[model samples]
Target: MDRAFRWAFIGTGTLAKKVAREITASERHVIATAYSRNREKLCAYCEPYNAYPAISIEDAIDRSDVDAVYINVTNESHYEVCRQALELGKHVLLEKPFTMNASDTEKLQNLAKSRGLYLAEAMWTWFADVPLQVRAFVQSGKLGRIREVYMSYCAYSIGYAPRVSDPLLGGGALLDIGIYPITYAYRLFGFPLSITCNGDIKNGIDYGEHIVLGYDGFDVKMDVSIVDTKGEAMIIEGENGFLANPGYHYGESAVAKTKSGVDIFKGQRSYLKEFDSVADEIRQGKTESSFIPPQATLDCMRILDECRRQMNLVYPFE
Candidate 1:
C-alpha cells in the first residue's frame, strides 16, 4: 500500500540472511522484522539490516508493520509456514520446491486465491535477464523450434552432510538441487509429456538422479548428483542453431552459435528483478504473479513428484 513494502522473513538461515541483506539494501523494500526458532541466531542474522527479531512465527506474521512474509524454512516445513502466513492475510514469497508434491502446492494456491492474497514462489532464475533475452530470441525465431535441452547440476557430497543425506529433512538431489535444472527445462519447454528417472538412493533418499523428460518434438536430459560433480551448464538446441551457457545455471553470460560463428550475451545478477514483479503484483492487488503463475508452480511440483515416484525416493514427511 505504501511506496515501500514492509517485509518479514520466517527463517534466519543463510539464504534468508542473503535475501534480508538484499531487501535492506534496496530502497523499494524495508525489513520490518524476522522470525526464527533460534532467537540468538535470528538476532545475529538481522543485525546487519537493523531488523527486529520476532520471538515466534506467529508474532512475525501478525505484525501490523509487516506487509509480506518470506518463507525460507526447510523443505518439509514450507507448506505449513506458508499456510500460516496466508491465513494471517500476509502476502508470501515462498522459497523454491514450494512443497514436496502437487497436492500441497494446489492447496496453497487455492487458499491464497480464496483469501485474495498474493503468493509467489521465489524461482529467481525465471526473473533473470539472460533467460528473458533467451526467450525473446527464441520467440523471434532465431533458434527455430527448440529441439532439445540438456542441463546438469551436481556436487560431490561424499562426506554425507545431514542436509544432503538425511531422509527426515526431505533430503535429496531432486528436491534440493535437481529442481533447478528441472525448473529451467520447464520454463523453456513447459511440462514434458513423459518422464523417466534413474536414481542413486541411500536411506530411502535420492543422492543422485538422471531424468529424461520427453515432449512431442523435443527432449530434455538432465542429471543431478550429490555424490558426483557435473559441469553445471545448460544447452539449448534448435533447428537453426543453438545457445550454450558454460555456467548456465548461475552464470552472467551465454553464447549463441550458428554456422557463422559465436555471439556472446552478457548479463548481471537478476534476483532483484523479481522484487519488481512482486511489487507490481501487490500494487495491482493480484493474487498471483503473471510472470510466475500458480499453475507453473503446480506443474513443477507435479514433475518433481513424478520424478521422485519413478526414482522410488521418499521423504519422511511424505
Candidate 2:
C-alpha cells in the first residue's frame, strides 16, 4: 500500500546487481535490503544501491519494510526462495526458469493465489514492446492470419567452462537460454498442441536443442545453442507476409512487410520498459501482472516439461 514499494533482492549476483542498478535509477521502487550467504558478496552487490544487506535469507524476507522480494538465484533455488517470500506475505518477482518443472510452478501459483500476493516470473522479453507491436500487426490483418513463427537464440559461453556442463546446477542451453525462444513463441502463439525436440547432451545436460512446436493452424521452429552463435532473431510469418525482429531478446527494432510494402519500428532497450511493468504492479498492489501472468508461466512450464519428457532429459532437482 506504500506509494513506492520497498524491495529486497534475494541473490547478490550479476543479474541481481543489474536489477539493483535499474531500481536505483528509477523512482518507482527502492532497494531496501539484499541477501546472500556470503557477507562479502552481499556487500559488493548492495554497495551501489546503498542497501542494507541482510545476514540471512529469512531476515531479508521477514523485514517489515520490504514489500517485495526479487528472486534472482539459480534455477533450482527459485521455487524455495519465492515460496519463502510469498509465505512471509511479500510479493515475489522471480528470475526465469521459474522452476525445474511445472509442478513446482503450480504450487507457487496456488500459494500466491491463496495468500492474495503477486507472483511474477521475470521473463522480461514478454514485456518488451516489439512483441506488442507484432501482436497488433497480427490482429490488424496487416500480415493476415499468422501461419508460423521461427525463433533462434544462441551464443558461445565456453568461457564459463564447467558451469556450462554442470548438470547438478541445472546448467544447459535449454533452461539457460532456450527458454527465451520458447517463451517468445508461446507469447505470440500460445501453447503448442505438440512438441518434438532434439538436443545434444554433454554430461547429462542439453548443450544445444532444436524444437518443433505444432499448433492447430500454425507451427513454430526454434533452435537454442550455447556452444555456438546464431543470428538470434524471430520471424512471425502470416498469410500475407511476416514480421522480422533482428534481435528478439531485447529487440531494438522490428520490420513488418506485407503484400503492400515494409514498415520499420525502432526503440530503446526493451528490458527497461518491461521493468516498468514490474514497478507498476508492485506499487499498485496489483494481484495480476499484465506483462507475464501466472497462467502464462504455468503454460510455459508445461511446454518445457513436455519437451524435457520427450527428450528424456531430467534436471538434477527433478
Candidate 3:
C-alpha cells in the first residue's frame, strides 16, 4: 500500500482498454506495460495512460517494475499467458472463464501455489456487494428455504464479437456471457449434484445454451446466448418470497420480497474494485483472494467443463 501497484497488461482489447481507463484514473495503480498482437492498437492503448507498450508477452512481464500481470487475451491463450507470468515470478489476475477447461485451470493454480505467486480469476460479481448481500439474505433464512432459481444473460453479441463464433479463439456463449450466471450459481449454491445443458451450435461454436444445475432440493435454470437477446435477469425464489435483479451480473442493486415487506440491497459496481482489491492483497503478501478464492474458481470451471461436455462444444484449439 505504500507504493503504487504496477500492472503489466497482456491484452489491449475492449476489456483491457476499459480497465486501463479505470486503473490510470487512480493513483494507487499504474499500467507499467502493455502488449497486443497489433502494434498500432497497442501504441494507441498505451498513450493515454503513458504506459510502456511492450513488444511481446515476455517483454511485458519480465520488467522488474511490474508487480502483477493483468491478462485479458483470447480465451485459448489464458493458460499459457498466465503460466508465463507465474513462471516469471509475477502475480496474475486473469479474466474469466479461467481457462478452456478445468485441467488447465488446476495446472495454473498449482503452479502459482508451488511458486508462491498470487493468482486469481477476475470474476467481478463476487467483488461487488449486492450478490454477497443477497447470499447473506438467503442464508439468514429470510428467504425460508430456497425452492427455485432462474438467471438469464442472453445478448446478441455475434455482430460485434466475431470471436464468439470462432472456434479457433475458444469462442462460445458458455465462456462469454454464460460464465457470469454460472459463477453466480456456484457462489450461491456451491457445486451442483447434477449438471445438464442443451445448446445451439452453429459453424463449430455454441450460440446459446439452456443450463440446469440440480441441487438437493431445487434447480437453478440459466439461459445464455450470443446470437439472441432474451434480456438479462436473475431471480432466486424461495418458499417465503424471491429476490430479483434486472442486470444480475453487473447490476449495483437488487430487490428482495417477502411476506413481511420488500427490501433493497445496493453496492459499488465499478470494475476498479476488482483490480484494487487484488493489488492490495498482493501487497499484503497474500497469494489468494478472499473474494474470488481458488476453490470457487476451480469449482466453476469444473461446472463449465461438464456443460461443454454435454453440449459437445469443442473449440479447434482445445
- Winner by lDDT: 3
**What would the per-residue lDDT of candidate 2 be over residues 1-318, giving only the tens digit for each residue?**
536667898987777767666756766677889898899888887787778989888888898888788898877788899889888888888989999899999999999999999889998877777667766666688888778888888888745745456787677888888888888777777888889999887778887889999987888999888888875988889888989987877755899889999988766664456666786776777877888878888998998888888778887666
The worst-scoring run of ten residues by lDDT in candidate 1 lies at 157-166
Q: Rank the candidates by lDDT, best first.
A: 3, 1, 2
Across 1-318, the per-residue lDDT of candidate 3 in tens digits comes to 468889999999988978888777888889999998899999999898889989999999999899999999989889999999999999999999899999999999999999999999999888878888987887788888889999999888876765677888888899988889999998888999999999999989888999999998999999999877888999999889999998779956999999878989999887888888998899889999999899999999999999989998888765
Model 2: ten consecutive residues of lowest lDDT: 157-166
Per-prediction TM-score: 0.93, 0.94, 0.98
Q: Local distance difference test, per candidate? A: 0.82, 0.81, 0.90
Model 2: C-alpha RMSD to truth?
A: 2.0
Residue-level lDDT for 314 in candidate 3: 81
- Would you give me the overall lDDT of model 1? 0.82
Question: Candidate 1's residue-wise lDDT over 124-174, tens digit each?
Answer: 877677776765666677777779888888888645546567777677889
lDDT of 3 at 49: 82
